[model samples]
Target: MSNIVSVFAQKCADYDEKNVQSAIDSLFAQMGGVAAVVPQNAKVFVKVNLVREMSPEKCGTTHPEVAVAVCKRLLTVTPNVTVGDSCAGMYNKGMLASVYAKCGMTAIEDRTAARLNQNFETGVADVNGKVLGKCEFTSAFLDADVVVNVTKLKTHSFTGYSGAVKNLFGLIPGMVKVEMHSRFPDLTAFCDLLCDVCEFARPKTVLNVIDAVWGMEGDGPTNGKPKFIGHLLASADPYALDAVAVSLFGDPRSMPVLQAAMKRGLLQDDLANIRFDFERWKAKRIDNFDAPPIDHTDFFGNQLAWINRLAKKHMVKRVHPDKTCRGCGKCAMHCPAKAITLVKRKAKVDQRKCIHCYCCQELCPFDAVRFRTSLLYKLARRFSGKRSKNT
Candidate 1:
């Protein structure tokens, strides 16, 4: 615990294959070489944020070039490297085939020696988590000797920021994620659970690499605008990686997931104790970066009849599908609250039953679903802004 946390970061302007590979090799060499983490003959699982079946251009998942770069480096260590992720979709052969093909992961297998893991079996592991005792994890994730967690930097509607820790949530398959969300709906609880899962998976994760070459803002992990971050980050500690990645956007303290981890004494309060080797990368940092906007409707402290009614009418943020919806029923299928119904072709969310989890926005392949804030909510944010400044 006394040892300093090491986080390495460098700007990667684009997903140029040779450029990314060289950067990885250079970062590893600077950090005491690749042997510092992966050993020869190790069975390495290159875990990418294949959160959904999307092209790398969407900036939704890890770039194929980045995955291939890590796989190639692992190849220098061992031949048993496999790349995989269990995103928010059916984990069948047909689905996995399409996801891999669409996400440019097939290119990783084609161009490199790494195999595409299509394993759909599930297994339970004891995380010794603070929130829950154990969790259901994909066997491919649990069985691997080493898991190189390759993640994308993005903003999540649920978690304040989607970085290294939130990326590990993909380790749990699509459906289990829905169940877990149902169990822990509060932001602090959900974030605590996220920390539990990350801590559980940390032992097997030899390295955590974030693909910030191009990142996402606004509503993300599924729908958002792609912004060029021009950076690649690597670290032995996932917590440290997240700490550094979120800093580039703004104050990490404003982020709830990061705060939850720190509150649990899982991470350092500040990065002063951590060591970085980026060498003036801050000169390229985005000063006007657009972080995902937050709605503080988490205050349901009273259940009075009139109070509940008022909250029902004004406090809740509504999800509405616009004209862009292709009516694929992904929202209806994945809705944990069973609040969504496909009327004709468009997905209709029953406001009475909706939990405002924002799962629809997170998983919708098309950028169809978005938030509709109420009048009173806007007024509340205005007053809260001044209150925050005064405090």
Candidate 2:
């Protein structure tokens, strides 16, 4: 395979409304220029990561300035550019329209007259004979001559981190994401499935732009601490883009998603092959940021045969919301196990049926689901921690 991954980074000290546009424009120019990838007059679909309904200050979704800059650039090539993402559980186009309005992209629809194609359909993706059934997708995605994947860099509770690859997962539509999660319950398996989804939609994603100007750390994608990285990254390879993102945090190899991607041969693990324009950008470490701990042996340990016999398999439980949830039904809609139900406008979990796949927590629009560890599990972890220190 050709060494197809190219990354260009640009440092912009401010994310304020005044400088955001110029920064994006400069980013576009430095990253091989968008014109080279997107042809003039081609039907281009720009997929922005709008995972949840939160203001730009919350850093829960892609910055509208980033999207506006992309649209502005692409419009130079084609007026056929369309921008949209299937929001989690809610399909209120007006809410998304409002986000665009706040970010100065209202002109995409109103002024520049860019097409807003929102109707998506269910499709199937086959991964190494394992078929992911009933995936909801926008027809514009499949029909587009080129796709620009714009994503935010953030840490995730389940998949380790969310970047260019995880952003596309939103395209699968609301509840269908839950079903996929149920099918591939393990993190490694789920990431493999994500790669398959990318392969199937490879033709669509011709370019990737990651908004790292401001990102989330420590249990994010949403509901995490925001860190200002003051950088913009662009690449043609999603894997390469994600690989670079993991390095920015500290240890890329330690990340489960990157480790899984490396094992599957989906990306180059060698950082040597990957080039970085450090002159334009610099790495900033996140202080006091601890990646959520996982039971390596339980999740990836080979002693499963022994543990299964000794400890009863803990059935997955729906993380209880410490506070009253907004009753958005996003969890119910995206529960892959279908274990969550709405009771009097509140979400109720049937622990017996929950597989602990964590789709509910990841897809919760309200960030209400907090992982609850039982007393016994806590004791076990305590013992495990002591044993590791002694060794």
Estimate the overall C-alpha local distance difference test score of candidate 2: 0.67
Mind sharing the TM-score for model 1? Answer: 0.92
Worst 10 residues of 2 by lDDT: 382-391
What digit string (tens of lDDT, one per residue) describes model 1 on residues 1-391? 3247889887677888888988888778867888788988998888888887899999989999999988887898799998898888566677778889989999987899999997889899888888978888988898899889999998777675788888888889888898887788667788889888988888899899999999987677688779889889999888778888887876666677777777776677765557874346466657767665553344343554564456446765689999888899998998888889988899998988777678888878787998887777666555545221101
Best by TM-score: 1
Residue pairs whose backbone atoms clash in candidate 1:
none
lDDT (10s digit) by residue, model 2, range 110-187: 645566655555455433423454455656676778888988888776776788888877667655666677778766
* Structural similarity to truth (TM-score) of each candidate: 0.92, 0.84
Error of 1 at 350 (Å): 1.2
Per-candidate clashes come to 0, 1
Error of 1 at 224 (Å): 0.7
Candidate 2 differs from the real structure by a C-alpha RMSD in angstroms, to one decimal, of 4.1
- Please identify model 2 stretches exceeding 4 Å from their true place: 1-4, 90-107, 110-113, 121-136, 277-283, 294-300, 303-305, 308-312, 315-318, 326-330, 342-345, 362-366, 374-391
lDDT of 1: 0.80
